[model samples]
Target: MLGIQNLSLFIASGLLLNVIPGPDSLLIMARSATQGWRAGSAAALGVGAGTMMHVLAAAAGLSALLATSAAAFAIVKWVGAAYIVYVGIALLRSKPGKAAAPAALPPQPYRRIFLQGFLTNVLNPKVAIFFLAFVPQFISADAPSKPLALVVLGCVFNFNGMLWCHALAVFTAFASQRMRLKPRVTAWLSRLTGGLFIGLGLKLALSKPN
Candidate 1:
């Protein structure tokens, strides 16, 4: 059906990949821990939206350009790295009130959080390359429409990823509630996450095109 092959294997592989810790998962978890589940869901949805862009790009064969063109790849990579670093710095600079309740801690506009998640996924040229390389395996050669096949495969992967991301958000929020972390402790967690983001951003910046 739809020129798809080994779909079970593809879905299994996608699930495993989604479980691996990455910027997408980290952003969702961080938002859930600091804000509530709703905020986490916003981030998760934003990520899903970003995945749709990649899916469309893949269907249009734009990803192939990113995979082959050094200049295009470098431009996107630097922009993505810079954005991630900027977000991390903002988190590091944020200071929550010592007495603020978990609910009372300053709330970032959910729209901004959503945009953060969207850019986090969409701006990474590596993601486009990964889709170009990975999504094709399950699509049969000589498919009726190669572009349609790519879209189907990309949508499946994104759906599975969204499920995992939302689950992570819920779980993180639940665990944080259980622990009842103090405001000071939450602040420290935020800072730690910020540092991790910085490290991840630098790593991405330094990454060689593959």
Candidate 2:
């Protein structure tokens, strides 16, 4: 069983981490800005699903393998970076007019958005490494069931992440409505998001294992 003090600390740490915008958050915001709340929500749910997979992997000690193996880490890192860059390119190529005219553009299937979100996190080795490192800190070595404790803690973290992501989607969706009226603004937003995705991809590619 988790102690109250440990649980409290974990919750605080999780919230603090979630508040700092990362690749997942950026993706959600970009989707919300371009598509709508539905797409953003799908993306957030996808990320949550992916994170849960990491939690399961961590419980099974697979994430630890990723953390320790250079080849495995590199492969996942490159794949993730490539995928992000691909998404950025797709965004850059997207028609600005379509973005400005939400009603005119065909609605994107939520399943596709969800899959993109899932792949983005699942392929990112850094996320796996993060789980491997972060979750164990709050787990007592002498705990009755370490794996169960990890799952519980991971659920708490993921719940916090979902709440934050959904809030971001709602806010971005609201702002997008106003921004969509200005053709120029909508165009610029797409370009900015595309650039952000590309930059994040490059950063991920260049990152060294800690």
Best by TM-score: 1
lDDT of 2 by residue, 155-191 (tens): 9999999999999999998987865556556656666
Question: TM-score for all predictions?
Answer: 0.96, 0.92
Clashing pairs in 2: none
lDDT of 1: 0.86
lDDT of 2 at 188: 64
Q: Tens-digit lDDT track for model 1 on 13-115?
A: 9999889987888788889988988788889998899888999998898898888888888898899999888877866776665554653235778998899
In model 2, how large is the Cα lDDT of residue 105?
A: 23
Candidate 2, residue 14: CA error in Å? 0.9
Task: Return the top candidate by lDDT.
Answer: 1
